[model samples]
Target: MSFYSDDASADELETLGWYHYDLSRHTAEALLLSNGTNGSYLLRNSNEGAGFFALSVRAKDSVKHFHVTRKGNGYVFGFNEFPTLQHFVNHFANQPLLGSDAGTLMVLKSPYPWRVEEPSIYESVRVHTAIQTGRTENDLMPSAPSLGTKEGYLVKQGAIVKNWKQRWFTLNRYELKYFKEKACEEPIRTLDLRACSAVQFDYSQDRVNCFCLVFPDRTFYLCAKTGVEADEWIKILRWKLPAVTLSVSSHR
Candidate 1:
């Protein structure tokens, strides 16, 4: 479990600055040179919540800096530029660590300038529109259930269809029920279908349905069981489908 994977030489670490270790707090404190810029900075490691600290050195400065701290059950980000030790303490005092936000302070010890090259919202929209309009018989299509009628049915059990390539799939009553049961057991955050390889759809204990939509980096699942559910799923998918297709196309 260490989240940070910075690899640098011991001499490089020393060049950054001397570190003060706090075993009780599980942290290593040190001053770091901001990249290669004239400015300097302080960095501390909470061991990524573990017990070990890794050090590294830099020859330049970073233009932007971000810090992650524990807050509630997740994490919150703090931003600053060449912050002083006093500023660090005051900021931490006002916003104490919460369980939601847990992690060490990642100090960017550089003033290196950078730029982002993300697609604009309008570009994204245009790309998606093109993808939707470009679909043909050979192209991937939504699962059969999503294209079928919107009627509820009684199911006894369910299973995933084999050789399924396209993302949208349907489930029977039992499958729908199973999906609901599984979804209810987990918190909304944990049940994020975006992170899941496939979503389980439960119509009833005996009927289940699931589908997998492949993405460049990951796969998305649809948890629709009934016709209505399928329709709603399709609507959302249709809205996002173009964007996914466009991204894939751009990469290719």
Candidate 2:
């Protein structure tokens, strides 16, 4: 018998939307309520094996647009004990960016569910864990054919400094490979999509089209010459790892 012998069948399964869980519009409205400052909000239960976290950068931490997660919803600023837009407003009320006056709230751009995989665990393409003992699940494993190659500039990390180099990025069935140049014999950097659980865009200030590809072992900060290219990559990447549907009820 299979460990998940009682796995949900197609008929038994619920049809989840891009935001996931097919949550009620009311829940979504309540959950994503922001303080109306820089329009930052938290994504609760982003994906399997993860908890509530920020979809955008928190103005308080100044962490940029990278996804930030925590174990509990205790007295955290955005993730208040009583989760509400009011709580977020109250917490950051005094910030220079925010004030007593209600500011404009920015809505989440992508409706697809977001991915935030747990540390040290790659997404298993196979159902049986016993069969995947030695092999790591770094591959993207698209259901159909891959989207193929793209041209962009990726930021290469050095021992101390970071360098921006032009590279050719390829999306294969299992991984995202980047070559130093179009004709490089081998890839200079490889990101296992199965291990990469989350991705964010416009995270840094250096470039307008900057994006972040996050994995357990490392993070790739790639910059595209144009915003169109950055969004183009995000479209295909999110197809595999969508956005999240959080439950702000835990705010209590």
Candidate 3:
């Protein structure tokens, strides 16, 4: 369940060489920025949600994540839509993609090739595809262990500034914690999951994949990199709610 469930389809995509089935947003950014030149690009499963793909390209000194939205059986990146990924690549190869502000032009010069011979490709693809498909490893096969904890990067809104900053978040059995960075020794804050009344998606926010953690004192807003990631986090947190509530009842 971690990758495309259809073996034939996945094998076909693998042959493209530019389709990286297992790359995460941050990992993609790191690889493209550190190893690739400007215009170096690759395609991967979008964190946004099911049936979505992302275009990660080295734009200027940094990498930009663009969701290639599905449109009426076709796919779109910018202004134009293509019938297939092959056509999309062919069209963009000659035409330069306009920068966000229309200031610079980015050409698809090189493709960050896929490593077919890598030993980890199978596992990575499986996990990633499962995420997109909204199924855990356990769901795919009973022998697979259930996920007890979830950790990833999410943008959190500050209480005072109301501005968003990406933080490393961790959710466990008893509490949820966020750190300023992934390697930080201490957490910025921790919320007892027992106090969390509910976790729900907040579509009111002017962003995609926004969710709210409802606590008695206040509500915390968080934005995940992709809709699928947000949904998974919400699922795990909600799953913990019943146990935490039972613990409270036992104490009473």
- Order the candidates by lDDT, highest first — what do you get? 3, 2, 1
The models' CA-based lDDT, in order, is: 0.32, 0.46, 0.75
- Candidate 2 lDDT by residue in tens digits, 1-252: 111233342212122222133233344344334322334433332333333333332333231232333322222433235343334334443432322123432333322333334469677441111223454444433232243334445554432467666677777654778887878879976766756666679556566778887777677777776777678777666544422211221243
Candidate 3 structure quality by residue, lDDT tens digits, 1-252? 234555654555567778787689899998898778889988888876756888888887978777786554456877778886567667766856557664656777888887634445444321221232676755644312133477889999999999999999876655789999999979999988767877889987798999998899999999998999899888777765645453564588
What lDDT would candidate 1 get against the real structure? 0.32
Residue-pair clashes per prediction, in order, are: 57, 14, 9
Give stretches of model 3 more than 4 Å off. 1-120, 124-147, 243-252
RMSD of each: 20.5, 23.0, 18.8
Model 2 lDDT, full chain set: 0.46
**Top lDDT model:** 3
How would you encode candidate 1's per-residue C-alpha lDDT over 1-252 as one tens digit per residue? 123233332223223232332222221112233123333223334445632332232323422233435332223343432133234334443533222133333333332222224455553221111234566744634332233222222222222542322222222211221223332443222212222222224333232353344445544443434555544544443333433454565586
User: TM-score: which candidate is best?
Assistant: 3
Better of 1 and 2 by lDDT: 2
